[model samples]
Target: MNAINITSTEILSDSWYTLKKISFEITANDGTKSTQEREAYDRGNGATILLYNRSNKTVVLTRQFRMPTFINGNETGYLIESCAGLLDKDNAEDCIKKETEEETGFRIDKVQKVFEAYMSPGSVTEIVYFFTAEYTNEMKVHEGGGLIEENEHIEVLELPFGKAIDMITTGEIKDGKTIMLLQHALINKLMG
Candidate 1:
């Protein structure tokens, strides 16, 4: 991997936060030098949190329309996922906290950092910070459905932890980050 040298990077499009691009490269590993163009979308890193209710054995999630998914094949594009948002300026932790409240109506005191992963390494340059937190009825401070002005018409969902896990295999939940967080909770016996 270190043997590869990126000769140049060209931006093909930057209409969205995701920018498309191409690059030329040379590799010493295979003693090959070639001009290859590829896309690299960098929208900055993001954070996702799964709020679990130990007593109720439920997990809070959100549903929102994703244009990319709509065009790709999902007619509805209403993805069921954990509370998430881009870390525009704040750090990952702070970003998740704000997002959790805005997207799920739950104010989390402490979020456990579980892991980090790249959504799509082939093209997207976004890494997602995964988190877990416990939710109580007392945490409800507002009715969250995302920012309307931001065009985020989100639907908050609180389903049994087991049911949420089942959604993964049943083809209901397709978001990668959401899947990982749910699996983490089940595998770690986070539910009381």
Candidate 2:
């Protein structure tokens, strides 16, 4: 089925990020009918995940504040997550690798591709590219986090496989891509 063509669009908000109102229509593959015009967004590529294997049977996650969740009665809204960032560059793998080193202080190799999917397809167009990399504790050369001037306060968490599951069930691990990476590794027996 061919995707609908954009008929018209409006700029809702444009800053560091952007929001748009778009109108489009879909032509059914079966030629049964043509759907009416619909409105959606065109949020560019904006999210990714970096999975790290410690070689001793655990993964490294990070805790950080999310303003949206915080305002939704989440209190501190600190979430446990993998080394992740937005996909603004031309290369997804390169971007995730740089984010892993910058956010977790781990220099890794043998980056393996996993799944690439949307983070929030219903409202937000956040497509996430997931990955896995084998690493050791020795790879750490510097503390990982966003620059302080950006108001980022991250806490690194090195947790066992089982503990990561518990965190997921308890809502401590709220990021979708992070959970997906953990589950993917756990299911495939890739982490050890």
Candidate 3:
């Protein structure tokens, strides 16, 4: 088995939302000698989506414009994602709870963790932990409040589970974290 060890790490930039750094390393696979550096966005406090299942076989999602992708020619950049967020010293359950209320205004009674992944293992070290919450029509969700000042304009949408999967396969839902959740649900037969 090949193993890599970290010799040292240096922070090139730091901010409330992002951190850029470089690292000195050694690869034992074939005595590969090299130095690697990465620019990482702290993205402090990850993100989440509320999958509220309404009657008629539909689940609620959010449509929001992502600036990062917008510049890349993704005109809308509107994403269909599940409820998720960063650990940030807070356990997965707690963080999800907070994001659920903030993003969708739905109070979750129960949560089941689906999966977790590093958003971008190549350059950034952002791990998005995802889960599914069982919500009923009785739940009261207020007018969603997102980071408007941050230029985030979002609209809540309810889509059929099958349609959501189709969106993922068709590349309509492009966010890595959201894809992870949808794939897990599909593979595990949990999207009821």
Who wins the TM-score comparison? 1
Pick out the ten consecutive residues of candidate 2 with the lowest summed lDDT: 32-41
Task: Write out the backbone clash pairs for model 2.
Answer: none
What lDDT does the true structure give each of the candidates? Answer: 0.88, 0.74, 0.66
lDDT of 1 by residue, 48-143 (tens): 999999999999999999989999999897899889999999999999999999888888889899999998999889999999999998999898
lDDT score for residue 82 of model 1: 88
Residue range with the least summed lDDT across 10 consecutive positions in model 3: 47-56
* Cα lDDT of model 2 by residue, 60-149, tens digit: 888888777888888887777788777675578887777777777777765888878877677777777788887787888788875577
Ordering by lDDT: 1, 2, 3
Question: Model 3: C-alpha RMSD to truth?
Answer: 2.9
